[model samples]
Target: MDLQIIQNRIIEIRGQRVMLDFHLAELYEVETKVLKQAVRRNIERFPEDFMFELTKSELDKLRSQTVTFDWKPTTYAPFVFTEQGVAMLSSVLKSKKAIRVNVEIIRAFVQLRKLAIQNSEIIHRIDEMEKKYDKQFKEVFTALRYLIHPPEKERRRIGYKK
Candidate 1:
């Protein structure tokens, strides 16, 4: 599977990056219900940080804000699994397909982390350059503008010296 495909499924929720169970089920080629059942059977493996159920309102918010969410209305709030939770799934789901998909999913998560770090470093460098150049450029431009159109002479004090 393309890492980009997996990455696109990842979403930031509750201040952590997570993948919804349905998306993972689709990736694993299993029904969403079966996946949920497996997770419930291995609930101990998943802590609060590893997995959590969204509130009804939270799901609604996602549906409204993101075009990717085309979830039909359902009685149960869908569970979201974090990176660790996805890794833990490989153990519970012993099928070869599950294992393979899990590996790809883990890779996708790692790639995203790497990307975020790179972007942050890039932004920091950009900020440093801006700070270093802002004043110098301002002075240079001021000088150039002065030469191009020198400030108007003081108009002889407009007929009176205060």
Candidate 2:
């Protein structure tokens, strides 16, 4: 029900962001097996672009790296649902919670994209400012160095410490 919980389920897999089947099932308040079965029944709805099973290596890497789940290394690898796949899932899931959660997940993704774009723009502007000030900063430092240490001809002791 909480959007924040659903948003954190988004993860990067196979060079694209996706949601794992178990996380989706949890969000939908369904068992993982039920979710997988529903997807199987509506296989045509989910094309390769929409959903794909994780390769053994990929699954292994996820299991080893993630602290989130205690997934046993089963004979079958987990399925990943892309943005499109998530959208399609609502039709197959056939529950009020699934529908509401799907909508929330979509909104969360859009918000995430907006935040990423805003951050990138801020970083680009800061980089430009750094470049613009680099030469000016170097010149100021050079002038300060000269002021701190004058030529030998201009060097004269004003007073000696006792």
Candidate 3:
């Protein structure tokens, strides 16, 4: 039920934050096969927008870019659950731990949103500062270039070199 544990379950793949099926299974205290079976049995509950399987290329990209524990090319593609699908998981996975973990996961999603918004603001400020100082920086660069590399007319003769 720890938020940190749920937050750690989130991963960035395909340029979006998502939870992989195996990680969700572990969090819900179910075997990966069991969780996949439940999802398969209740496919209607998960629409394409709510849940989708990662393509082989997408999976490969994730594997290449991200560090993982005990990861292998899965026989079946991993399912990615969006916010709505995460909520639906509670209904499909009925257990005390599931309920508790689901709540933590929801909170983690909200925290992620807040963090993203905060990061956007920070990036915006950085962009503004960069824009404001760009002219000054260019002038400084020009001045430094002149100091470091003088004109051919200003070159001094090397007395020792033949």
TM-scores vs. true structure, each candidate: 0.81, 0.77, 0.74
Kindly give the stretch of ten consecutive residues in candidate 2 with the minimal lDDT sum: 141-150
lDDT of 1 by residue, 7-126 (tens): 999999988999999899999999889999999998999999899999988988988768766686677889999999999989988999999999999999999999889977866765
Q: Arrange candidates by lDDT, highest first: which order?
A: 1, 2, 3
Ranking 1 against 2 by TM-score, winner: 1
TM-score of 1: 0.81
Residue pairs with backbone atoms closer than 3 Å in model 1 (clashes): none
How accurate locally, in lDDT, is each candidate?
0.87, 0.83, 0.82
Better of 1 and 3 by TM-score: 1
Clashing pairs in 2: none
Stretches of model 3 off by over 4 angstroms after superposition:
129-162
Compute the lDDT of residue 29 as modeled in candidate 2.
88
Candidate 2 vs candidate 3: which has greater lDDT? 2
Choose the strongest candidate by TM-score: 1
Instruction: Give lDDT tens digits, candidate 3, residues 1-162.
Output: 778877877887666678989889988889888998999999999998778999989887877656754585568988998877888999998888888888889999999999889977866765576578877676765564566456667657657877
